[model samples]
Target chain A: EAGVAQSPRYKIIEKRQSVAFWCNPISGHATLYWYQQILGQGPKLLIQFQNNGVVDDSQLPKDRFSAERLKGVDSTLKIQPAKLEDSAVYLCASSSGLVFSYEQYFGPGTRLTVT
Target chain B: AQTVTQSQPEMSVQEAETVTLSCTYDTSESDYYLFWYKQPPSRQMILVIRQEAYKQQNATENRFSVNFQKAAKSFSLKISDSQLGDAAMYFCIWGANTPLVFGKGTRLSVIA
Candidate 1:
């Protein structure tokens, strides 16, 4: 019954720094997702994981953005050498990963600021 | 690739009034899912409603309902008897054969 949980509700770092965020999906959830939301924009999927394996990462900035969902329940998203453009909210979500339509439960996103 | 568009960047409505938010998306898949999410200042994304492409009848939840025009690629959210709590940024999203994609979003303001 618990919702998706995220750590480090807020973070501030300078350009060229590195930042990491953690997420704990709901119990028994098989799919995890990380998204980035810039001001005045909608959230964009950075990566998706199905039980510890990546389902999609085509939109991810592979050079700088990396995410892993180890053990299939918890996920971590990292941004190395964070750029000013990377200043946004990092959102974690999870779903049933079933064939039918399932809603994703979102966490109180981590707000990251890169100066 | 799938793309979502929310042409109205902002809208305002008085309390107890009704408002509609427009959304459109492009997709090649015949069966997929469309959703509307609301994000308030607290920064948590909340699901408002969803529509399935395979279903012809529209979906409704309490005071929230959707007008799904599959051929026109239009999905709109209509909130009846809007309240101040309805003030937030609404995002239109779709996931076809690919991953989910969200639109720029429309900010709604409720004037008491």
Candidate 2:
């Protein structure tokens, strides 16, 4: 089985610019997640989707960050008018069942740098 | 709200030796799960071990084992026969009905 795949392993953008990251989860996985990991810190959940529908995004900064999983297989996370504080690694993960009950496979994260 | 804490920022162990990484969590849920994830410099997070709250026996996988103390709300990982491949950032996580919460992570280094 293939693992979760993410695009553009590294990205650099200027402040106030817009950037987007893509994620293609493992086939047959029902749950997908996006997390942000700042340097020296663990990944923090940004959004979670169960199939095509969203399960939780309370921590997401709706004002500038948005994500969507249109077909339930692939997802994209976007940040518009990015801030310097947004420079961090964005990780995508998928699980066949609820995270607490099943193992989640993570993809090689996209490291974003805002100038 | 659930929170995971890794007090140690970094630790080093000699090859073929043993080392323990400490973690403590705060959660009100009676039943939940705890996990240790390893992220090498490659940036992919891998599951090292997992422990269920209701289980009495601590979870162990090969040379990796977890000492889960429910009463103290502590979960620590013990790596035996440490190898250079074990060098990475180790994160402690708390999982319940809600989303998983992660610790700051401990960077482990193995000396040859």
Give model 1's docking category.
Answer: medium
lDDT of 2 by residue, A1-115 (tens): 8888999899999999999999999999999999999998888889999999999998899999999999888999999989999999999999999655688899999999999
- Residue-level lDDT for B98 in candidate 1: 42
Q: What is the lDDT of residue B109 in candidate 2?
A: 96
Query: Any idea what lDDT model 2 has?
Result: 0.94
Give the Cα lDDT of each candidate: 0.90, 0.94
In candidate 1, position A32 carries an lDDT of 86
Best by lDDT: 2
Candidate 1 local lDDT, B1-112, one digit each (tens): 6789999999999999999999999988899999999988796788999888999999999999999999999999999999999999999999764467889999999999
Q: How many residue pairs clash in each candidate?
A: 0, 0
lDDT score for candidate 1 against the true structure: 0.90
Model 2 chain B weakest lDDT span, ten residues long? B93-102
